[model samples]
Target: MRSQDENGRANHEAGMAGGEEMEMVEVSSEMRRRHQRPRKEEAEETEEAMSVEQVFEGKRVPGWREQLTFRAFAVSFVLAVMFSIIVMKLNLTTGIIPSLNVSAGLLGYFFVKMWTSVLDKAGLLKQPFTRQENTVIQTCVVAAYGIAFSGGFGSYLFGMSETIARQTTELNDAQNVKNPKLGWMIGFLFVVSFLGLFALVPLRKIMIIDYKLIYPSGTATAHLINGFHTPQGAKLAKKQVKTLGKFFVFSFLWGFFQWFYTAGDNCGFVSFPTLGLKAYENRFYFDFSPTYVGVGMICPYIVNISVLLGGILSWGVMWPLINNQKGKWYPADLPSGSLHGLQGYRVFISIAMILGDGLYNFLKVLLRTISSFVSVVQKRGATSTLPVLDDGSPITTSPAVSFDEERRTELFLKDQIPKQVALGGYVVIAAISIITLPHIFSQLKWYYILVAYIIAPVLAFCNAYGSGLTDWSLASTYGKLAIFTIGAWAGADHGGVLVGLAACGVMMSIVSTASDLMQDFKTGYMTLASPRSMFVSQVIGTSMGCVIAPCVFWLFYKAFKDIGISGSEYPAPYAIVYRNMAILGVDGVSSLPKNCLTLCYIFFAAAILINLLRDLAPKKIAKFIPLPMAMAIPFYIGSYFAIDMCLGSLILFVWELINKAKADAFGPAVASGLICGDGIWTLPQSVLALAKVKPPICMKFLSRNMNDKVDTFITSLS
Candidate 1:
């Protein structure tokens, strides 16, 4: 039977190639009867054809039994587990560097790659694996794991430390006694870490279906799998694998040069300089640390912008005012035994900037969500219900289906009948959020928790909107906004660290590996890998990583504390909050700038109105503007991403232009080569680090200098 056009929607059973515009069809009872049986028959016929081809193609492997061999399962499990552990270690140790996260994602992609390749070899599926499949799976798994683990572990560790420090310090000051209850704090943190799982559910639909973000790491993995499946891929893989081995050796040598020679104190090599102009420095300065820049590159550009913006607003605007008012804007010389004035200024500025941004963003999100909800309800009341089939069946026989059918149905049903039933689901989610809110906010004081409850929904809405636009997750934005608000309320010194850590976790979970995951998913969809399997693999991998992350963080925190360097244990932002609380007291909460809060409220109100309007509009118009989300994100973050968008557009334009001039294969091959080259570049560094070799050229210069200083310092100091 010929497939019906059904408007423009592609027939899943048809197995059509290339990009074609397809229309979505509503499968009424008749349409289902017409198409379902034929599709199943076609699928069976295709399977038979595939089996015949396999018999002629090569040696026949047994069907299900052969595909699920012990060897394959063992390899997949080991790779997944080991990769998860390695990724957790690197992420916890290195902060949220994109490359590290991407590498971790690549490991996850490998499993998917292997799974697909094995299936192809067995001829269980007709379509062979592609690089894109690995990319999507790896990206999703890495992103999901990164966000959850980072947010959970980071929050638990930092929150525990700050809460204990605050309570004990308070006790010590008031009663002239010291308290040691690190164990209690640790126990409390473990309990709170479980809350991280709650975030996963709300985010699942958004990440998987609505946005359809692609994970690049999964694509890489699929490439590997494809290599094993096809003769062409196999030959190329062999050559490339050998080259990668050599590259690893080269990278290791280069990595060591900087690590050994130019990285220590007094070599003038490894200082972390705060960017922009410092009031005390009287000029802009640069820090000569390679680690920070390398790290900065890996960090999401949006985050960097947010951080930098916060610093600028605080130091460039707020601090100068405060200092000038206090008659200490500038001193002729450094104060006796005092902290670096510039650093101190920047720290304060950063704190205020966080306060402003968090406040503004959170309020906007809350208002937008509420507005969207109300608007949805209003639309339900006004719009005509979907007409049932003539046979009195609820299913419609339309060739075209609407987007968000479930939501529309729910709203329609809610509006058609009683007022009380309509309010039930809304109440349930709210009640659940509210009950969970206290547990989530348990570390904070009751009043502070109250404040956070008031603020969190706003941030959540903003995050949802932000996610809608760029196909980026907004977990970090919400978490950061939450932390900042909490810190501002609780006092900067005591609450800052807890909030910072929590924010770090949130950022790590949501933002760190988002792009890679989206790319992977897109590949999987194209390749026709089982979505259920991909989802299962992601959950399993992420859960394993999350389980062990806290322990690793604790160990790092202890080591850093001993060395008197902040390291992972002491985030500078949190420290600033603690100090402020000690000096200023709770009255400081009153001192929070009203301008920031007002701005937040304005954004929130505007978002709500936009969401309402969008929801009330016709579906066609609604498609053009995700107004609910647009209201939630800050202008600054949007602007930062605009830069990325422009760059991407330029690249695409150049590629299209080139493709027009050259063979179609040339442009695609060049693009593929660029991607492969980028991925390959990391292998050399990994190998070199493993081998403990000095790198060549400029890297060697840095390494040699580092070694000389270490030797000299050891002799003189001893």
Candidate 2:
């Protein structure tokens, strides 16, 4: 339950899986009763919601028809670029991104509000910024940055390259690799990313209204938008922005200062051996990473602790033990990166743990979703004839409806995207994908594409339904399933690696976008925004992302020659892991180093057992149990980041102890500023690197013997 949002990837999963506590919180009873409320009460409640939403003088809440203004789109583009850069940087570096939905809403409000204020002062204001418009900006900006993660630049997409392949296998893998190209990447995204929107259009009411799935991220975002439109909320938001700006500058300057000494590999404060040389050698040092510190603050306490625990267990214990037996367990003379050596233990064990955790959650959520569906259906009964709207809400003349619920529902269902449009759009998009994908990958057959499309909607529905319930999107897990399935189906000779990667993208995009769209719908629902405007903004944002993500990635791709290499600035840890998975899917366990499968099996079982114990344990005890997925991260990537993250968590812990209320109020803004500043630094840093500008110093650390030798050598040279 270490959520994807915690991973610095897609916020589809929102923040760190707040453990199992969320599953224990029931919304169905309350939602069902609210839905069954009487008609007269519903009308009055609806009137109240309408009155609240119409905060601007003489201005009604803009309808769906008038919400998608050019101004909103323009502001969304600016925020989209800003967020995309931050998201993409995190994706490549730690792959742990906090949910920025609230950030997006706040920033969107700040920008548009500033612009409108100027116009109002000049007496040229034609329109006021409404919560619905803010909702659009939030939806649009999130959709755009989401592409940075779902687009797979740091994972499966980049995983299909020779560079990543070289990290896993000693074989001549260049022939099998399919390196990324800007044109194909953009085209591929456009083809697959939008279909998910269509796939879930028909299920909006079923998921939101009937099932009463609490998409927490979306709901939280809606609340932020609603609050931002209030007079008091605006003042607080402005203060938060100023705080965010202050920390952002401090973080950026800190990064700039650190950069001046990072002229060579392992130079600068980033690689400081804080725990002494021995611990540093084991990857135990704090890298002084602001991004991870920020991520640590944003993630739940359990997640940060789990990651640190995993790192200590792996790098501090297991790895050293395994390395000792290298001559017997693996070929002693093999290169460090070789799969037939130590790297095999690192990669496969991590993968096993990842797959293990993923499978358990997948089954757990699937069962929960099915149970919920059946229970809801039974309640409705086969003989019951509730007149349902096209959007799936019951046409109840109930007078007991809550004001917030009825008003939101009215706005939500006001303009249902037609059932025909949803169905036809899915069909046409599927047809186009089936026809074009084979040409794109060639190894991915038309039948394969057709089968994937046929199966995608069902999986998309399952994923969307599960995410609504858990606030955890298993998109990558689903994508991993695709990689194994398609890779095995195609086999190695047919370019299985590329085929599997491509299929993963397709499956992931469909499921991911569908859930994302649903999440946005929830946001829209609570904010009294038009469903149509939400849909349009999502589509527009996604379209922008399809183009923006790759171009941004291309900058890093071209600028950083060492991007995918292990120990490099942006190792893209998941890329190598993903490619190795494809290799395993094709080559089977025979490719694993000697005894590697045995270790993988042990850790895999261990992961499942850990999860099982956490679930069975009492709530107080379960909160302390380490997450297998969080632990597995350090198994492959090493423990340096864990130190950085724990520091972040420690800072927050101290702050909270000092003043809980203030900590809760401004903690995220502080974290966001730290994260955004460091994240944004990468853009200019990449530009400088691309221009071949070098830091004037190389702050290297050496062993005592090596340092003396270097001094002696320098003396000789002088």
Candidate 3:
């Protein structure tokens, strides 16, 4: 059943890959099907579709109230906590988080299915598990943990810390560095996160129905949910649960085992130096991180390869060449992690590439969104028989609607959120944020907050439209744009760094939540779940996340003594990068090391050129092109995890060669286990650290001379 579900997801992706042409073909086919007599298979399909329609029409599907169950919320809260830990760990460590939608849905199904079965066995079952309920669980859990990602625990927010400030080259304003406080963090999130939901609420019908956007992730998740409620899927899910459970335990034990060796700095599988000392100096060894390995499994092959290529280019080639110039290029005696030396090149060059790529994609998506909106408007104008509402929703139009689409439209429109309420809610939240945010981060003036809110809707629509077309959310890009604009606007003497970072959080929350809400609407449409249920679930989840994400980050911040420190267990690499971006915005290019700006310019142009080449190149050649964004990550951090990810990719490649079906069926389950196990281990690991309990062994590797000297000293002492 998982295999079938995976195939459905694959098919949806492939169909979407055809882009606008596929959409046109699908529309034409629907129109043709309406006119033609159905063949046997087509008739069977029609029958199945009719049954689904009947379910949504109220014979089987639950109402909005029934969908939002106490049991679902209970399950969501538990899973949200667990997934929050996982997301926080990923955020702090690699700053790259794979989507956990499928895993959340799977786990939701597993837990609920187990409950229902036990109840049925005891004859105490009052209600059976429904796909709608499972969707609520998935939605709530995703939204809750999503805050962990968007909360900037590892980026803009954490970057405000004094620890991260010390790592930069610029003189950071003492007033700008804000430490993580549980009280203020929760309050900050409450002020910022919910506005985005209301920002896009009025456009739900326009985006999902009139635009007919794909929203691939939401559609795939819906398919996965629908698949799981079937009898065959239940049995399959049981096997998958066992598999996930078994590996999760193994990964947990592995983490525990690895912990013993990490009694001292650089003494463990994490820094195993797999390629010996010379390569290790260049950061080209696998650190044996299960989280990254699992991430690689879930991410596309190209992304993993791109990261490795980036690592190789930076640590392998560029850094070595730059280091040769020593005192001429940068001061020779600076700390390895100091931004005044080689670290400057690493951070700035990567930032250059990131900004370049982000700018190109932002323009691309913005233009595409504009063009598509124009096209949609033209089509709507050409066919205007039915009366429309102020929101552009048709009153009774049904032309060109397919059987399935018509069915979904009926259910989706059944509980439409009022436009007045949406607009009023947005205004209230924005007003509150504009008023309250200045108190939270005094550097960010009320006007900055107001401007971010004012322009947020336009950017939110672009992001939502782009995400619907291509499953990629550019929320972070929008945030960075805010950072630069507001930071420069505020200037250095006014604590622009903190202002920019704070504004980033506000802008990011709004746009990210907007796109996310639209995606959930897509899921709700496909699964016949009520928009009201999804919206309520999102609010509850966001509320949970406002409290939970900050608390989790606080635990890590308190427990791990060296968090956000370069070369430490949790480098939080993006913190320094984001902080530097704010610095650049305030101080301009003068803060860079000698010749760094020239290198940055070269890389920036190179990034844009590479993107153009990828788009213009033939598919056979284009697939090999490395992603600038993926590659930029390792420039500051290192290649060790890149090796780990490639190893995962290699494992997947071999498994597919051995048995494609099993790989497709159980691959995500296995990957999720590796990630969750190691991720969950962070909880106990933090607890132990907070208690000042150290591991028993220090498995350090030394140079031959150092080893000989240690041995001689030990012998003489004896």
Clashing pairs in 3: none
Top-lDDT candidate index: 3
Which residues of candidate 3, in runs, are more than 4 Å off? 1-59, 381-400
Task: Report the lDDT tens digits of candidate 1 across residue range 1-718.
Answer: 0001000001111111000001001011111122235546845843543332232234332222222233333443444343333333322332222223223323334455556678878888554434324433443344333432343332233433442244222211322111213453333333332232232333433443433222222323333343344566445444444443343344335434444443223222222222322322221223332222322332222233433443344334554464453324334364421222333333233333333433343354345434544443455434232211112222223343233333222322221223343235334433443444334433345455444434443343344333222222334344444444555455543444344343333332333222222333333332333333343344444443444343334444443332112222123223233233222232233333323334334444554554445446764564344322211111211122222222333444565576744322232223222223322333343455446554332322124667899889999998
Candidate number with the higher TM-score (1 or 3)? 3
Q: Mind giving the per-residue lDDT tens digits that candidate 2 earns over 71-110?
A: 8999999888888888778767756666566577777888
**Global lDDT of each model?**
0.33, 0.77, 0.78
Q: Relative to the unseen true structure, what is the C-alpha lDDT of residue 565 in candidate 3, on a scale of 0 to 100?
A: 92
What is the TM-score of candidate 3? 0.91
**RMSD of model 2 against the true structure:** 5.7
Candidate 3 Cα deviation (angstroms), residue 707: 0.7
By summed lDDT, which 10 consecutive residues of candidate 3 come out lowest? Answer: 1-10
Using lDDT, rank the candidates from best to worst.
3, 2, 1
